[model samples]
Target chain A: MFAQSLVGAAAAVAAHLETLLAEHQALPVVEAMGYATRGGKALRGYLVLESARLHGVPEGHAIWPACAIEAVHAYSLVHDDLPCMDDDDLRRGLPTVHRKWDEATAVLAGDALQALGFELVSDPRCHPSGEVRADLALSLARAAGARGMVMGQALDMAAEATDVPLDLAQITALQAGKTGALIRWSAEAGARLAEVDPAPLTAYADRLGLAFQIADDILDVEGDAAMMGKAVGKDAGRGKATFVSLLGLDTAKLRARQLVDEACDALSPYADRAENLRAAARFVISRSN
Target chain B: MFAQSLVGAAAAVAAHLETLLAEHQALPVVEAMGYATRGGKALRGYLVLESARLHGVPEGHAIWPACAIEAVHAYSLVHDDLPCMDDDDLRRGLPTVHRKWDEATAVLAGDALQALGFELVSDPRCHPSGEVRADLALSLARAAGARGMVMGQALDMAAEATDVPLDLAQITALQAGKTGALIRWSAEAGARLAEVDPAPLTAYADRLGLAFQIADDILDVEGDAAMMGKAVGKDAGRGKATFVSLLGLDTAKLRARQLVDEACDALSPYADRAENLRAAARFVISRSN
Candidate 1:
């Protein structure tokens, strides 16, 4: 049931993104942007849509923030794949933006996509209230800026300079800013859009984000590169620090299960209305890709 | 006289940016953003503040957009100077961000600064009305996105691949997006803040932006590297087409003068209240660097 809902949310957000980008002139940057945003699972968008549904926010109002998060996520991937960054050639079984076009196009496409994300959230059509739009933009900036995703990227780059691998606590802190920050923001977006207290959802997100990372680490160790659509076991190959490196494989799996349970428990106040969110938590740990 | 006001605006915006960025954790990316935003003319910020003054907007409300434009301008420069891009070593008499830090930090810093620009424009303290903030953010996104600055950058990159230099008309159209879009947006920001018609300032910006590029071309032909803090005559050396190359040095200067006259004439409705803006038009063509 959760899988079906997620797929539906992904399709809706994808269509919305396609339409929004269509309005832009048919420049190479625009073409690269469309190419870059495609083929992702759209998990972030799904989280946003589901959370909004849980709170009874209309789909019309909810789709903007959902597309906004997915745009940001796609941009992060585009930049992260740049040669100066991770230097990856493939993502989702396709050439990365830089590989498909060039480095300049990749950089500009990612930058423009980030701007588009802010534009979507700030559009009046996204919500009737200006305050809500401003709040959404502000929170997004926090999640994606120096205190959030960029911070994690910076730390990751800096870590590559030192021979010493990060300890478990250090890796956790780094991941919290990098991957975990966006996930938490995605989970809490519905509450922000609905103008409700986000504490419950935020609690759920805190656990789910960490669990998601653990699953990613597990996948890196055991998952197939063909299925993942990119290289796997890269951390282990590079002697880089990761959860699986700190904790044994069995122990890491156990921790992810525990985290999923805690994430589900945090959603108890919403009762069965949050069943999809609960299932999402479980899905994070079990997904093959 | 206009130069002094511009200097003062630069100082005020710099101080505000320092304070705003100071709140973030003292990470390398934050430090790079501060470094990137400093030491330029801050002409864009001056345009925002002066335009707001012409429209009788308060300084408190005006500073947010003023700083926002400057931040965006700084981010563009930082990215444009990356090794994969323009590959510059100096800017504003200091090492470029990529030169001072590593390439990764430069990329992350530029990305974060862009987010900071959106954050400032969307903050509630910038305005009481959410609609006003959203409008500012939306307009800014358009100016800075694929349809605007990014579009120009993409064109400029594509132009490099062709053996033939861009013709005058092509170069003009390219400059309109690369530099003119932001200038036009900055000039009209006050009217947006006042929620009044932006026609007069928009007219002024249209001419002023073209004139500013002409002046840059003139400077590239004759200015000292010490004052400009960047290599001059590179366009000529590379045989790249420019206003100076197409129109010749003397003709470019005359054209810039003509544009300044038209830009100042556009401000006739504001009369004495627009003295600073008129001086700005004159200053754009006269400054050596």
Candidate 2:
């Protein structure tokens, strides 16, 4: 049931994005932006919609933040896949933006997409109240900015430059900023929109984000390249310390399961209304890709 | 007088940015961001502050938007000078971000700075009213996104791929979106802050933006490369059409002068109170570097 709901949410978000972006003049960067954002599982978008559903926020208002998170996610991927970063040629089973177009177009497309994310959340259409819009924009900016994803990326780069591999604690801190920050924001977005205290959602999201990263590490070890849509074993090859490397693969999997359970437990206050969110936590650990 | 005031504004904005960015972990990307934003003329920031002064908005409240625009401008320059973009090696008499740091650091730094810009404008410290913060974020995003700077950049790249050089009108449209968009936004910021009609400021900005581009074109033709801190003659060498090439040097200079006069005329509602703005208009045309 949760899987079906997630699929529907992803579809709705994609349609909204298409309509929103259709007005952009048919320039190459605009086209590249569309390409970059297309065909994701839209996990972040689903988190937003599910959390909103749990809070009784309508899909209409929730979709803006949903699309906004997805756009920011897409932009991060585009920049991360550039030659100077991950140097990945493939993403979502197709050429990355920098590979499909040129690096300049890739860079500009990513930059514009990031701007569009903020635009969507801050627009009056996103919410009737300006306070909500301001809150959403402010939180999204913090989650994606220096103290968040960018900081994680910088640390990752710095780790690559260093002779000593990162310890488990250091890697956790890096991942928290890089991937966890955005995940936390997506999970808490519904509560923000509904003007409810986000303590429960924040607690749920914090554990879920950690579980998600550990699952990623597990995927890097055991997943098929075709299913993952990119090369696996990159973490081991780069000699970067990941959860699997530090804790051992079996231990990493056990930790992820424990975190998933904790994440679900944190959502118990909402009872069955958060069933989808609970399922999402379990799915993170079990996902093949 | 305007030049001195601009210098002071730049310094103040720089100091504010330092305080905001100090919390960032000591990573290469953070360092590159600092380098990218340092020591510019801060024309956009000056516009924000000057326009705010004209509207009787306090400098304390106005400084946030001023710093925000400057941060966005710095991000654009960093990305524009990348090896895949203009491939310039110098900026503001210093090495470009990508040249000073690696391309990955440059890309992440630019992305972070853009986020910082939005974060600064949307933060409550910028204004107590959430409505004002939302409005500023929305407008800035639109002005800096695909419909604005990115659109201009994509057009520029596409024009390079074509056999035909862009005509005068086409180039003007391109530059208007590329450089003029931010200038217009900077000028209108004060009106937005004051919640006043921006017609006069908008009119003043439109003409001023055109004159500023024309002046840049003139600089490419005749300015000292060392003083400009970047290569000159690249436009002519690339066989790109510019104002000087299309209208001839003398005609281009005359057109810039006419635009400056009109920009000043648009500010007549404020009379002598807008003298600094008028001086800024003339300075755009006459500045050596």
Candidate 3:
């Protein structure tokens, strides 16, 4: 049931993004924008839709932010794959945007995607209350800007440049900003949309995000490239410090399971109504990709 | 009087941006963000502040959007100057961001600056009304997204790759998106903040933006590299289609003057209260850089 819901949310978000992209002029960058956004797991969008469902928010209103987060995620991936960054030629088993197009197109497409993300959330169609829309845009900017994802990316790059590997606490802080911030924002979005205190969801997301990263590290170590749809064992190859490297594979697995349990427990305030969210927590640790 | 106001607006916006950037972690990307934002004419920011003043909006509230537009402008310039793009080495008499830092830092800095733009406009402190803030963010996204500045940039790049030069109408349309969208947005922002119709200011900006581009073309043809603080005569050397190239230098100058007159005429609704704006339109054509 949870898997089906996740698939449904992905399809919905993809369709909505298609509609938005269709409204744009037929430029190559626009085409690249659409191309880059395709084939992601859409986990962030799923979190948004599921959390909104848990909060009784309508699918119509929630879909905008779902698409918004997906756009942001796609943009980060596109830029991350640039030759100057990760220098990856492939993502999700296909050529990255910079490989298919050029660096300029990739950069512009990524930029437009980020702008589109802001556009989707702040648009009046997303919510009737402008206050809610403004809050959403502001929070998203915080998640994506200098103090959040970008800072994490910079720190990661800096760490890679040095001979010294990062310690556990340093890695945790970096992961929290790089990936955790967006995940937390996605999970807590419904509460923000509903104008409720997001304390419980925040707690749930904090644990879920860490579990998600640990799972990613584990996948990098043990998962097959075909199953992951991208390069695997890259962290170990680069000698980059990750959960699996720092904690050992067995201990990392144990820690991820514990974190999943803690994440599920944080959803207790919603009782059985949050079973889907609980399933999502388990899925984070179990998924190969 | 116009020069003084423009300089004053630039200083105020710069100081506000400095305060905002000071709050972020001192990452290399964050430092690059500050470097990229400095030394511009701040024309778009000036338009925002002057328009807000015309609409009786306080400086405290207007400064956010002013800085927001500047950030967006800075991001575009940073990305445009990338090695894969315009490959510019100098801007405002100093090394470009990519020259000073690495390409990765430049890309991340530009991305963060764009996010900062949306954050500033949608911030609660920017306005008292949520509706207005949301509107500002939505409009800014439109101006900066695929349909606006990015489209213009893509078209410009496409034009460069082909042997065929764009026709007058095609070039006009391209420039309208490239530089005109943000200028129109800046000019119309005060009315949006005041919750009034932006038709008059939009009219003024359309003409002013066109005139500004023609003047830029003229500068490229006849400018001193030392005074321009960047390359000159490159458009002619590349045989690119431009206002001066298509219309001839004398005709381009004449057209710019006529557009300035039309832009000034559009502000008749404000009568003598719009003297500063009239001065701005003239300055757009008269300035050397």
**lDDT of each model, Cα atoms only?**
0.88, 0.89, 0.91
Give one clash count per candidate, in the order shown: 0, 0, 0
DockQ of each: 0.68, 0.77, 0.76
Share of native interface contacts recovered by each model: 0.68, 0.79, 0.80
Candidate 3 local Cα displacement, residue B140, angstroms: 0.3
lDDT of 2 by residue, B1-289 (tens): 7778878988998998888778888888998888888998888998998999999988888899999999999999999999999999989888889888889989999999999988977876666353535888989999999999888888888999998988998999999889998999999999988889989999999999999998998899898799888888888888888888899888999999999999999999999999988988898888633
TM-score of each: 0.96, 0.98, 0.98
**Model 3 per-residue lDDT tens digits across residues B27-125:** 889999999898888999999998999999998999999999999999999999999998888889889899999899999999999999999998877
> Per-residue alpha-carbon lDDT of model 2 for A50-95, expressed as tens digits?
8888778888888998999999999999999999999999899899
Ranking by lDDT: 3, 2, 1
lDDT of 3 at B105: 93
The C-alpha stretches of model 3 lying farther than 4 A from their native spots are A128-132, B128-132
Candidate whose DockQ is highest: 2
TM-scores, chain A, per candidate = 0.97, 0.97, 0.97
Once superposed on the true structure, which residue ranges of model 2 sit more than 4 Å away at CA? A128-132, B128-132
